[model samples]
Every structure is written in C-alpha cells, then in structure tokens.
Target: IFFVSIKLTVPLAYFYILLILVRELCEKFPGSLYIPIQTYLPYLASVVSTMQKSSTFVEVWAIIEALFYICLRLHIQWLQYKDPLEASLSSAPMLELWERRQLWERIMEIETDDPVSFVTGWFFDQDLQHITRYDVLDFVAWSMFEGRNQEHLTGDELGQLHDFVDELEWKISEHLNRSDSLIPEKNTDKNEVGDNRKDNQETPITSEFTQEKNDLDLSDGISSPRRDQGDRPRNQFRFPENVDDDSPDFFTNLYENYHNWYEQTKDRLENSDFHPVQGIRNYMAEKRQQIVEKEKNAMATASNLAENAYNRLVSPGSNMDKQLMALSHATQSQLMDAWNSMVEMKERLETAKFVSSKRKVLQQQLRGYRHLLDSARAMSSAIPSNQMADLMRKITQCNEAIERVEWSARDAFVKATGYARKNILQRTEPQRYAKYSHDPLLGISTYPLMFHLLILGVTDGGLRVILRRRGFERRTMGPIAYYFHPGSSDHTEDENEELNDEDREMTPIVFCHGIGIGLLFYLPLIDEMLRLGRPIFLPEIPYVTGFRPWQSP
Candidate 1:
C-alpha cells in the first residue's frame, strides 16, 4: 500500500509542478516564448512519465527526451528576437516572423545525415551558439549583402545545407501560417468596428487608408521622400528638370544661389560699426588706471613712514626727522592723486552705463545670425542631394568669418564697459552692495576698503605700523608691512609657558597677496596662525586699494 501510494503521489506532484510552471511562464513571457513552451510542455510530461515505468520502452523514451531537450534549447535561444523599438519596426509580429526566417537559414549550414545529427552539429558551433539572436541575424545579413567565404564547406555539406534550408523554410512558413491568426495586422479596418465606423464616415482618412482615389484631392503631387533618402546610392538623386530657357544645371544653380547668399551675409557683418559702448569702456579703463597708480604711490609713502618711525625708535640721535618730513610730504601728494583718480573713475563709469540700449540691439542681431548658421549646419546631413556638399562647405566658411567679426566686436564692447571689473566687485564685496547700485566706491558697489589698516597699531614684536592719517601729515609715499606679535597681550604668560623649547624661537611669516586680492580674504589664515601661537605680518597691496587719481589718456 505504501509503495502504490508513493508511485501515485510522485506522478501527481509532477503534474501539479508542471501546471504551476506553465502558469508562471504564461504570466512572465510574451507570445514570443509562451507559444513554444505551451506546444512542447505536454510532450515533455508524457516522455518523463514513460521513463519512470520499468518497461522495455523506457530506453526509447529516454532517447526521445534527449532529442526534444536539444531541439527545445536551440529553438529558445534563437527565437528571442530584438524589441520593436530597437528595430524601429511598426509591427513586432512581423519582426518575430522575420527572425524565424533568419534562424532557419542559420540551421541549414549543418552537414549531418539526419535531423538529430544536424541539430547536434549546428548547436555545438563555437561562433554561432553564444551571443544574441539579433547578432546572429546581423552576421547572416553581412554574408548576404557582402561576400561570404564558403571554401571550407565540402560538396556533401553544401548539398545537406541546401536540403536543410528547404525543409526549414517549409517549417517556418507553416509556423508563420499558424501564428498569422494571432499576430495583429499593421493596419486595422476601423470602418468594420462600431464607433470607429461612424467616426470614419464623418472624418477624412490618410492616403494609405482611402478607398476612392477618384474623390481624393491631387493638389500636391506627393510629399517629400523619406528623410533617409541621403543613405541611398548616388543614382537615386532626383531634381525637377528645367526645360524653359538655358538655365544652369541643378548643381550649378545651387552653387550660384549659395555663393550669393554667403556674400550677402559677409557684407552685412562688414557693414556694421564698432558700437560707441567700446569708447566709453576705454575711457573708464583709463580713469581706473590712474586711480590704481595713485594707490601704489600712497602704499609706497605708508611703508616709508613706517620705516622712518622704526629707524627713530631703534636709533635715538639719527637724522630721521628730515627723512620723516620728506615721507610725509610724499604721502600727502599721493593721497591727493588717489582722490582725483576716484572722482574721474566715478564720472567715466556713469558715462559707460549710458550705451546699454545700443548694446542690447547689437547682441540680439548677433544671436539671430548665429542661430540661423547653426540651423543651416544641422540640415546639411539630412540634405539628399550630394551636389549640395560644396555649397554647404562655402556656407560654413562664410558663417565662421561672420562669427569672428561679431565676437571681436563683442569682446571689445565688454572690455570698454568694464563688465569683468564689475563682476569682480560683485563677488568680493558684501551682500548689501551685491544688488545693482549706481555708486562706484569702497564698501559699496566696488572693491571693499581694508578697515584692518585703520585699527592696526605697533606691537612689542618690532613691527613698524604706518598710520595713514599720520603719514598724510607730511608728504612722502612707500610700501608698509603690518606685524602681529604672539604673547604680547593678557595671554602672553600662559602662551610662553605652553610653548616647547624648540617652538620658543619664532620664524616670522610675511603674508604676500596677489593683484586684485585684499587683506579681508586672508583673515581666516591669520586667525589660524594666532591659534598656533606664531607671529605673522601682512603687507599692503597698491593696485587693489579702493582709492586712486585719474591719469592722462
């Protein structure tokens, strides 16, 4: 009873498992896979059941199972066609049928005597078994379109291959006929349906769907050929014949029209003037240069004042009075120069702002031409006529030339208007003056003032601090380096004790900044050094200073 129950339960379990597999497969795969699995699954089950019986037919069932498995494996691998989106096909069903044909041709290359031998031989080929079905079809396409070498194949192999090809073709045709009812047609007759019939009666249809050619309008002969016409052979080019007068050939006419268009474009670019905004910018730049020069002189005087004061402290009876007096006189002169430069820069900056309207119009025109040129270049590849190649080359040359002139004018206007300078001011200044403001002065719409210099004073670390007000009391000008001394304030005793014997000796760091950079940006670095209990000095830069005098242009 136990053995009889076991036999019955095993067969029942196998049936249940097979049914579950079919259900899952139906849900997971499209018809591409579902069709074959649905057709062969019942046969597979019967063979398995036959092999379980201890009869003489069990060995025969096993042989049949091996052959079915091999055929099924080969069929599954080759039937997995590429997507419709990839192939750019209107119908996926048509693509599946086409892939079926491709697989049939590939299977025909075997030289074996029987179908089982052929299947085994064909399946074991190193080059053909792996990779995608689409790739296999592509290889076949290359051999068909280009020449293929079949010298290695024997005469008997060729005969077998052709015979297999005939049989496979017949089988594929039969499968396609079977699947025909399942695959939807590319065009469905809407008039045969319910609401679609009423809609079709009221609305016009496309030429492809129209039944009556006599009632159709013939206003336009035909729409332009497909955009891929350029990919066809050179012999496919078609142009309407001109038989009236002795006009030039199609290509000659194209060349002449393009040449005239190019000349006109170049002429328009050449005719345009250098806008007046450039002059205003140049004037502003000149004034700014003067201010920068004056600031340099002032920096020199400040440095000299510090040096003179330091000399006096170091040497008691030195002839430092005369040197101090000369430095003071130079400092006053430099300050006056800076003041004059600032006033002139302000006036020129205002003048440069007036030509904003003219600049806008010029920019619009330049952009339009650039966009037109780009459109022309984009259309070049889609143009079917090979004769247009020469014309396109000429058009490209003309476009480049116009671009060069337009860009040069643009650059000049930018430089004259001090656009880059204003951008720098926006980034470096505080958020309060970050908005558009007409004012062009320190801590406002321009480079900020170095307030650190005003609060700076001498320390016990032998630093020579130059007071700007005191330096102006005399007249001379020079450069100055402000020094910071660690262990000079209330924390000095504790800092000194904390320092190791090796770190007790301090190496002074001279803080040098580049052009257009200010001391405020380096405050973080200064703070870090102070935390490390090390001494640092900052030198004043001239060109970056907020004040200056106007120079003679």
Candidate 2:
C-alpha cells in the first residue's frame, strides 16, 4: 500500500510541476506562447483526466510528456530566430547619444574589400537585425568619400552619395520614432498585468481566470492604458513642459544646442581683441592666491589645534587624538583642492589656442605651480608623526599632479611652436597588389588553384620545423613574425680578440618576403646567405602572403 501511494503521488507531482513550468514560460515570453498552449491544451486535459480515472493513465501520461517535450523544442528554435536587436530596441524608447556615437565609430573602423559582406557578417555575429547591407555600404562609402574630400570623384557621384546618406538617416529616424510609439504601450500593459496578478493572488481560481484573460488579451493585441492612468495618482510630480527626463532625443537636442553655443563663443573670442591666454593667466593668478590663503589657514588651524591639545591634556575625556585627526583631514582637504586647481589650470592652458608668446606665459604659470608644490612639501614636515603617513601620501600625489601639469605645458608649447618632427619615411600610396580590381568571378575560375596553395602551406609548415631544428629562433614583434639566427661569430670564445688582416667584415642579411606564399619559396636563398657565415633575418609579411588577405600591410 505504501508503494502504491508513492506511485500515485509521483504522477500528480509531475503534473503540477508541468503546469507551473508552462505558466512560467507564458509569463516570460508574454505574447509568444499562446499558439503552443492552445494546441497542447487538449493533451493536458486528457492527462489530468487519466490521472483521476486511473485507466490507461501511464500511456496517456507518456504521450502528453512527449508532446510537451516537442513543444519546448519548437519554442527554443523559434527563440533562436528572433532578432535580439529588435527586441532590445522594443524594450527602450530610444538609443542613447553615446551608444549611437560608438556605433558610428565601429562602422567607420570597418576596413574590408566587401563592406556589405563584412557588415553583414558582423551583424549576424552580434545577433543584430533591421539594418540592411545596402544601407551600411552606402554609409561607409559616403563617410570614406567625405574623409577624402571627395577626391577623384565627379560632382554627380558626390551628389548621389549625399542622397544615399540622407535616405539612410531618414530610415533610421523613422525606425526610432516607431520604437518610441510602441514601447510606452507595452510598458503600460506590463504594469497593468502586474497589478492584476497582485490582486488575484488571494483567490487561486480567480488568478487562473485572470491569467487566461491576460494571455487572450495579449494575443488579440489589446492593452489597458486608461485603467493604468486611472490607477496613477494625480498628485505625482510630472516632468517640465517640452522636457523628456532621461530621454535620448532630449539629450541629443541639448547636445546640439550646447555645440552651437560653443561655436558662437569661439567665434566671438576670435573676433574680439581679448586674448584667451591672458584670461587663463588671470585665472591661474587667482587660483594661486586662493592656494596661498588656504596654506595660511591650514597652518593657523594646525597651530591652534596643537595648543588646544596641550591645554586639554589635563582634562578628563579630552579626545585629543580625535581632534588631531580632524586637523589632519582638514589640511589634506586643502592640499587636494590646490592640486585640483593646478590640474584645471593645466587643462585650460592646453585647450587655449595660443601662439609662441602665449605658450611662454603658460609655461610661467606651470612653473609657479611647481614652486607651490615645493612649498607644500616643505610644510608637510610640521604634520604630527602619527598622521605623517596620510600627509606624505597627499604630498606625493600633489607632486605627481604638478609633474603632469609641467609635462602637458611643455607638450603644448612644442605643438604650438612646431618643434616636433613627423615621420617622413612612412608610405603614402596604396600597394598595387593590395588593390581589389580583379573580378570576383575569377575566384570561381581559380578554384583548382586552392589545392596547390594548400599543398604549399603544408610544405611551408614542415620547412618551419626544419628551420627550428637548425638553431633559428622564431619570434613575433607586434604583427610581424620573424626568424632570427645569430651568426657563428656571436658564439665566439674570445670576446676581446682582434680580427686578422686577411679577414673582411661580415654583415647580417635581412630578407623580406613579397606578395606570395610566404617564406616557403625563399628557403634556397636563405641557405645560400647562411653559408656566408653571416646572421640571417627573415621577417614574414603575412598580410601580403595571400593567406591573411583581410589584413592591411
């Protein structure tokens, strides 16, 4: 009898568990699980009936279990097909300005032969959707042309590119607007459902009925915004007119207004006789005066605290240590304020558009900060021994801050006076072999050549193993991989031995591979150079070696 009771309870327990799981799935997916539930309701009813009647209960239970498993599998597959990007957008009213800027930067960094395919692959990898390949390609092309000042392009081409960009921007705006409209409705519905569930929890039967009604309403595309509004209190604080609190659209508009204001300010400063460098100097002078006042106040406070501590030593419950700690904190705070002021002055000097004379003035201001730092350090010795650790830390920090300011000032002066030289040996033109001028159909015609390349690659791997055995060391520097073999002379026994008159100078050979299958074809040349008793260096240019075609050399 005990075994029979346990057997009966197990099936009922499973039925209840399945019901709970289905309810959770419905809540999680919202409007997505309606069709699956409708199709399986009959099977669920039969299973419940069989459990009650005890006739063919095992067979019916197995069948229902199989159907549930199948439904779950289908649901998972459906979830995989859903566009996560669209889902995220639906949850939010609009993208933040920073997020949009980051997205634009990522799009600009795409350096590929096929922008469309490259962007498409990225979207699929990132689980994004709603952005088409053509739109991405158009944006990339327009950005590239604009960066180059539309060089080598006709006027018609430029006009067409501009039109493409305008259309793409319009489409994005429309999509965002649509999201803004739909998200509020969804949020209201969710709030109403939550409130309804809370109210129904007192009676299980009523809760079940309410759950069914909510699911039905969701499937029929209905919401209760009026009910939600009626539930809200009238005395709640509201946002100001023409303002959207924490909304991206509002922030973007604010940013544009700020930018326009900055431009006007810059233009006014440029047109006026007032020099920005002079203003910076005046600001620095005021800050220095404030720092001097703070130092004097700190010294007075410390001296007064010490005298008070001496007087309180004779009293009960004096708390002299606490008073000393407070004084130390106050002094540290003053030092921190001074350091912050110096940092701000440095930033202002760097940002000011100044000539050589103005730069010299900024340098003088920086030197003043350094002198202040020296004085602060000298004054730190007066701090109590117990508090010396924290004071010393603050002094070190101030020293670092002043050093940074001096370095930035010098860098700014160099930039203003054109003292820094640029690298002249860097390549300016694109490589001929790197150009993607060949027809894509050539890939199909050259299909058989891939086998030959694969064989060469395998042979190259084997040759590398042999080179490793022959005392050659392979290493990587950034993106370039090279093989180095210190020649026989490097391992000579006598360090101070002079060369004989008959011996000539031996120089190492540095060989770089071209646009082909890497160093596999140059083994013979390497061998010949190695026989001359000189070191051999072979740097592998993977980007031009046909294997790493996606990379830029």
Candidate 3:
C-alpha cells in the first residue's frame, strides 16, 4: 500500500515543507504582506484535516494545495541553483552529526555536541569541495535556524564569513601598501618577488651573505684576521648553531617533504583548473608575509639592544656597565646566531600542500576556499589591466557585504559555528599531545589571549586542547561528576583523576559568563570541563547580556 501511494504522499510531503515556510513568513511579518484576514486559510486547512469527516471541497483543495507547494519548491530550488556561486553548494546537503561535529570541533578546537548537527556527505567531499561557504560560514541557521542567535552579523552566518574575509583582505592590502621592512635595501614590492624567484634563479640567499663573504675575503687578505671566539656570548640567548651541520627539527623535516609533495601535485592544478591549489597558494602567501614580519620584529629587538649596549660600553659610568656590556655582547652575538639559524631554518620550510592530502583537513580548508577562491582565481586568470578592475569589484562586493553584518549577526554567526557553545559531548579519536598529560597547549604568552575579553575565543579548538591536556576524556565521562571519586587512589581504572591534589579542592576552575546564555552557552564548556575531570560553576555577571533590568539592581 505504501509503495502504491508513493506519488500521492511525496507531493503531500513537498507541500507540507512549503506550507511551513509560508506559515513562518506570515507569522513573522503579518502586516508586511498585507494579506486579508482570510490569509488564515492554511490554519483552517490544518484544522479541517483534523476533523473526523471532511467535505468533498476539502479533499479537492488538499490535492490542489499539494500541487501548489510542489511548484513553489521547484521555483525556489531552481533559483538557488541558478546562481553559480550558490549552485555549487546546492548539492552539498545538510549538516550531519558526525561531519558537523568534526567541522565545528576543528574550527572551535573543542568537542562538544550541545545541539547535535549533521553536515551533508556532499559538503564533506574533498573532490567536489566548496570553499566559499566553508571559509566564511558561521551563521546560525535560525538564530535564522535557532530562536536565539543575537543576529550580530549581516543578518546571518554567511554574512559573518564575508565580513571576516573582507577585514583580513583590507589588512593584507594595507600591509602590501607599506614598504617591505624585511629587506631594508630593496622596497617591499621588489623584495617579495625577489625572495620567491630565488628558487628559479638558484641564487645564493641573501645579499647579506654575499657581503659577508666579501668582508671575509678582504680580512683574510690582510692576514691575522681571526676574530675572538672569546667574544661570543654563550650563557645567554643563543640561536641554533650548525643547523645545516646539525639535524633539523620535525617541523622543518615535515615541511621539506611537503614542498616536494606540492611539486608532485603541480599536474593536478593543470587538470582540475588549478583553483584549489591557487587557494592554498594565496594562504601560503599570507602566511609567508606574516613570517617575514615576525623575523623583522625579532631582528629589530636585537638591534635595539645592541645599540643600548654600545651606549653603555664606552661610558663605563658605573659597575652596571659590566652587566650591560655582557648584555650587549650577548644580544649582538645572539642576533648574528639568529640570522645564521634562520638561513638554516629557511631550508626546512617548503611551499608544500599539507592539509590537501589529509581528508578531514582538506574538507575544512576547502570550505575556506569555496566562493572566494572561485572568484579570485577566475580574476587572477584574467588578462592584466581588466583583471585588476574585475578583482576590485569582487573584493569590494565582499567587503560591503561583510561590513553590513551587525553585532547581533556576529553573535548568531558564532552560535552557528560552535563559538557560542557552553557544554556538550563530541565523539572524536583521542588527541595526542605532549610527552605527558598536563602539559599546556598554549605557552603563557599565548594563553592570556584566550582569556576573558570583549570577544569570545574564535572557537573551542584551543579550549579543547586545554581540556585534553588536563587528562579528561571527552565522551567517556561516566554518569557521576566523578564516576568513582571516592574510590581508592590506586585504582588503575581511574586514570582521569589527578591523585596529587591535597583533596581540599572543589574544582580546577570557575568561570563567570555574561548573562542570558540561558544554560545553553555552557553546554559545550560543561562537557569539556567534566571530560577534563574539572567541575565548573558558572555565576552571572551584572550589567551583561541576558539579564533582566530589575535583576541589575
């Protein structure tokens, strides 16, 4: 009977979806559509359907209603796919629990499934990857999807990603406008190109290296030119010496291999239109620029110290010069060592595709590429003069769309992407970190950045690392806060507990959140803490979100 009536039921199902959509619209904006008071026909239809007996008129109208819904749905689906940018994602499907958990976990850096979600298998495909929405999608569907989300972005999550990308582009553009500080002799415009071209020319690195060779040669010609090794500072900061002569760190070795991998994938670019490779390349360019700035900052700090030492060295105003002179020598010698080490370190960094080979990483990265990369590469492939203009328009459109996102939308966006999570459980393979548990993922310098701020941590990814380091299992936390808290200390079954505590502790941490989080904001956090064997008590903050005005007094 079910198979025989497939056509009948399928049309009804389609109609039901549209009916809900229309009902939502009507309820949301009753006056905007200016429908007559009789616009309540759908409700009457629903009520009549519930009646014990229906008239012939009702039966006839039901079939008509189903057809009308089918047409509306077809029109909507057609419109969605007509936009090339939108069409790619049309087949991406809805989020699945596992994929959504993974994506949300990867982004937020934590594992909590407060509100379970599912990411469609289509969207998960690396072969048919969509980068645009992946790159910028943090929008909560009902903030559009949920009743909550503050709707802090451009009306939704999609808008938030656009806004974030625009801000970053503007910053990148600004950086390019300024003079390149890395190679002081050449302007930034030439310097970046020069650095990249080194592989092509097979030239020896650095004009500085050439100059140093000349100075060495000249000094040798004069004879008796051996500088004092005694002058070298050993006790203080020392750069890694003999890097080429010595073994490389794991990061360096891995990156070197990755570069070779990139070369291997060069053909893939030609075959697949080279869009994804181009996205990775753009990301690498941005990262490379950042690396340059970091190097410059390090050098400038060393040079400033050197200058200060020179002032103290000849002055000899007091006994302090002894320490100051030592300090200066240490700083200068360390600087030289650093330059040498970096030259060695440079050998390890390869422009290789990493996240590419890994499926999970690929999906996440592809999401970042989708819409923007398609436009960018298309623009880049275009001929020069007109290319710049087209690129500018695309960029401007992206920027305008981003700037339009409101704070409420931002809040909603974060909620959608798992940024606004409080407590929950996520099933993931155990993360391997540290030689031993309890080693913090963040160094003290980096840790404070994740602390209380006007904004939230971009995602729970970092928080998750912290949780895993603390020795709590995410999904394995048993029924009780301590499944066996009062058990004997020697129980091998209880590896999660920190047996070393003085036993007077209540919890490892306590957080005070802005109000109106409505217990939901903490679902993720609560799950994380419990997994880590830590209990958290969340108190309310005054003059904050979600609190009543009368409660403030």
What's the TM-score of each model vs. the native?
0.15, 0.20, 0.16
Candidate 3 lDDT by residue in tens digits, 328-420: 899879867766664543332222232123323433443443454445434534334333234334544443343233222333334434564
The local distance difference test score of each candidate is 0.39, 0.46, 0.37
lDDT of 3 at 188: 46
lDDT of predicted model 1: 0.39
Candidate 3: stretches off by over 4 Å: 1-53, 82-318, 328-337, 344-349, 352-553
Tens-digit lDDT track of model 2 for 1-553 = 8445533543554565566556556557746774465576767544444444443555455455545445544544554554332333232333223444455445534422233344335345321133433434333443443211122123444454444343333333223323323333244576775564445332322221112222212122212232223222111111112211111122223333444565577689988856565676687789989989998888787978866876767344457667777889998799778767767645544344332234345456545544543453346344333233333334444444534444444455455445763521122221111112111212311111233356556856776897898779998986667999977754244432554433335567889888777787777888777665567888877646653432322
Candidate 3, residue 80: Cα displacement in angstroms equals 2.5
- CA lDDT for candidate 3: 0.37
Model 1 over residues 72-134: C-alpha lDDT tens digits? 444434333322122221212112223534554454433212332332233343321232222
Best candidate, TM-score: 2
Per-prediction tally of clashes: 24, 0, 50
Error of 3 at 143 (Å): 40
